[model samples]
Target chain A: MENPYLPYPVRIDEIITETEDKNLKTYKLVFLNTDDEEKFIFQAGQFAELSIAGQGEIPIGIASSPSEKGFLKFTVNKVGRVTTHLHNMTVGDIMGVRGPLGNYYPWDRMEGKNVVIIGGGFAFTTLRSSIIYMLHPKNRSRFKDIHVIYGARTPGMLLYRDELTEWEKRDDIYMHITVDATDDPDWKYHIGFVPTITDQKAPEGNADTYAIVCGPPIMIKFTQPVLDKLKYSHENIIMSLEMRMKCGIGICGRCNIGTEYVCKDGPVFTLDQLNRMPKEY
Target chain B: MNVIKIDKKTWTEGIGRLQGFYRLIGPVKDGDFYQFKALEKGESPDFSMLNTRLSPKSIIYPQSEVMFEYSLDETRDDCHVIKEIQVEYSPQVVFGIRPCDAKAFLLVQRNFETPEYKDPYWIRLYETTALIGLACNTPCSTCFCVDAGSGPFNDAGLDILLIDAGEYYYARVNTAKGEKILKDSGWSEETETKDAELAIENLKQAAENRITARISTDRLKEKGVPDLFNAPFWEDVAFACINCGTCTYVCPTCWCFDIQDEVRGTDGVRMRNWDSCMYPLFTLHGSGHNPRDAKTKRLRQRFMHKLKYYVDKYNDGIQCVGCGRCINLCPVNIDIRKICEAMNGFEPEQKSI
Candidate 1:
């Protein structure tokens, strides 16, 4: 229910660089206004627009969990003009961050349900929010089962390497990762695209099960069919969307398909809501 | 029933008196067409005329406007908010608006000042703008305002109504704001009958004769099932459409808008600009999926919305002023009236008047 249009100035205390994938990275930032932290918290599955003076702006997901308040973290990819400069930044660089914008996975509705997490390539940035929220100790019993099927192109391209290892150590969550082709001799998770792994896993799906997936457009297209075979109803399957978002709010027409505004009605939606949307996305 | 008449010479004085109290505005003859221009010391808007090239909504909701400016300081976290103070709007009088445009302007109020989504920019402009609906002395062939529930002398969405009878004119106050302006303008008095009726009847016949085309919409609700969504009858109507958004742009009630946020350094202002559904890019997703991709499907969406969908939702027909701007502006001459006629083709002989 937060206003997508209002953006508070968040100070970037520092920026962290993760992954040598050349196209993507993550930044850990701390809000300068301590008071705003209490009021300015954002949910996982929500995103913020990061901007630099004269350099341009881009949408980056809050890779850091909402529960971890004071500091803000963004897992971003250097796709276009703004993102390219974003990757070249130092720790003290000032950038504008607006939002916890768009709808997040409603955990209240998602509780007591089998939760499936799907991530592909840099699109995994959006899922990092949900992944952390599910892994949080306080919210563990709300979900029946937590499963993550994440994939990337190669070893160096994989994001959140340290966190991925730590999360995998926990017995409560199931983490399965795959890569298109891995050169690392030590690597032994899986060796195919995400969609292939999804098809092979064929997780059980019922009315109570929820599937959340994000990644490259191709991965999303392929994985949808796999989830369908699992008996996951469209209403129970959730996904995040990406577009060339300018105003991280619904006011900008660029991120809309018909009456649906990606920044307002959702960046996260059940497949049921997605069905009502014009097939443009 | 007061019948007061004045010469065309007194028109300038009347308008000048309006200029003394308000930011007086009305339609002025812009070559062959008319446009809403501010009334200076002595400017009486032409009453008997064609519609304006641009809508009066431009006055409130401009084509493009800078919302606010932002400045980024590399050292600071909070953005430097550059407050934009627009020029003060004088209490204004919008004179000589056609009945169709009046209705269109009235419809715009919801998007601007609705309880849930009140736009301060649109509201500020609307607060100072007053409308004076002018009767079309020689109504155009394409005018179906009456069918749309507004007409040559329609006063549904006006603060004041004016009807032209040859050399002189008749005026009726519709709102308290309009009544106040009338007192300030020192108009003789509003008449009870005859002059307004004579002008209305003359224009009505002129409107009907010019609009030789007809379509039955009462059958639309009965037959516009999902199966009829892609009927073959669509091709004939869509064949002439250019997809330039002229229909939507000139339309009095089309209210789709696009939001834009521009951040230069650390500072930025978000803006909401007008948008149309006709554009293919509007519905295309980042995943490269498009539902209403087909031109035929989009074309159907446009007419169906006018005749069926919006009606179902609002309990009112999607507003079309029937000003015929869509007809005249369409590149291939894809007339809306023609489309309605084609819709009737879905189940022709069965419907009766």
Candidate 2:
């Protein structure tokens, strides 16, 4: 029997360097063995523990949708040791990845609902996976007016800037971008925090919408009141959570917020679910 | 080497057969407390009361355990730390381990003995220990192991189960190791009669009905959140909670832990320590934020996890033995019964295939 504990050695076919930020990069990956490709499966918003050669595993969300089956993808920020090693890898480098574990975004319920996506900083990576899955060719029409509000600290830190620009142009998406400080004139947009822009630019409280918020703790705290003022219910406000996870499983006993394992029970939860957990980070 | 019965008139011969074990642990009286203790003198263990002071979680998943040892045996130039583990111990016999606590060992053994994160320290203790499961003659208010599929005389993980049949114990050998011990002891068998069956039933009824409190977890399992999330009821139950985690520590099945490195000068050992979700730091990271900070939030977490999350994910509740040690030892008297009763309203939708 194959050990669930042992990670399958995977070959990194391609790497997509998005933005000039020293931290973030997106890798386009496929199984080395063709048979494994057909057998492989993962849900949007689920994560895998990826291992670089000579470095151990680090949990990163499945950045590409299950709909994009030809290749597996992950958008990682080189904040720690393993990621730093991953950032130095070339096309043919071999690494290890061990799951498609954790829950998925409620796409079945999310369909036809006016979705408002609020994101700030590198935390937007998991949200980006949800957006990609929702906008696929077969599923795009099922969703109502989609609004994506994204922000970063500075022009130097803004991830997916070109993609954000194209998204802003598309008639389908009601997209908005904000930066904490603008360094140059090339960027023509709001010059303020994401919460500030969110309170001002969003198409107000009239429609039925599920507000998907992801960002730094400071941004999440500030944005909660803006959403409350806009009359979004706690159940309707879904947010992504980040914790110091080691096993990325419920067994490690590390990610217990109250009793919920953030790695298994969440990484994505409703504000109502967050209300029940311990305040510890 | 078949089934054997020691005469109830002379139970000492049977106990004498277990004389060679380095440690003979049995339920003994300490003031008013009846707990698991080392039995240097051969005496019949006390089982007329409730469970022990601890749930036997420490024997396998110890509260404080050394993962490995680092040693330096040379002077000056040759003084470099060599990792070593003291993985040997004299075989021990534990007396009167409840069915719930015994079954909990099944869940705990998998993690420590597995290929991933092979904790040799814990595995050593497990290998050397022999369990003598005692039948629960009086189930307390906190027991729900029967709901988790363990009974008063459940022989799931034991080498031997000594069922209390009023006058004397009815011994049942479960594993090869236990059968070997019995075969080595000179004994003869009498056919299991109807009288023994009647005595067993009487013990079961006394254990269940004598305790005035009851919480039907089956109803809680069927009904999920409506009763559980009502903050007012949860607050009432947990109002006196001091967050001491005594209930969790005494709990035979609360297997949560924390890993830390103890550094003394240039040398250090990484150790895994017991932790409870009730604590503020159980979920706290170096970052200045916590999700389960307050008493109400922590209380909600404990109830929801045991009643819903574990069942939803693992297909079986990990809380194997419903040993009431947690309830008995909880300083605040925060009863799990009231909490489970309140949360037995929302039957969560079954997982879609």
Q: Which candidate is the best by lDDT?
A: 1
Report how far residue A75 has shifted in candidate 2, in Å: 8.6
In the range B1-353, model 2's lDDT, one tens digit per residue, is: 12334566666665666665446678887887777767765676666657767666666666797543322222433222223434557777777888888888876665445543454556667777878788777666567666666777677778788776655667777777776666554444654656655666677776656545455666654543433454356677778888887877777666677645454544545456788878877765434466666887776777676665555445565343566666777887777765666665443345221
Q: Which window of ten consecutive residues has the lowest lDDT sum in model 2 chain B?
A: B73-82
Best by DockQ: 1
Per-residue lDDT tens digits for candidate 1, residues B115-176, read 44455666777778888877675677677776665676677778877766667766666777
- For candidate 1, what TM-score does chain B get against the true chain B? 0.84
lDDT of 1 by residue, A1-281 (tens): 22334445555566556667456667877655676566666778888877554444566677888777678888766655667777787776555566667778778898898888888888787677778877788888878888889998887788888888998899998888888997789997889999888877646889788888888778888988888887889998888877656666554445654445677668888888776544555
Assess the local accuracy of residue A141 in candidate 2 as a C-alpha lDDT between 0 and 100.
Answer: 93
DockQ of candidates 1 onward, in order? Answer: 0.17, 0.11
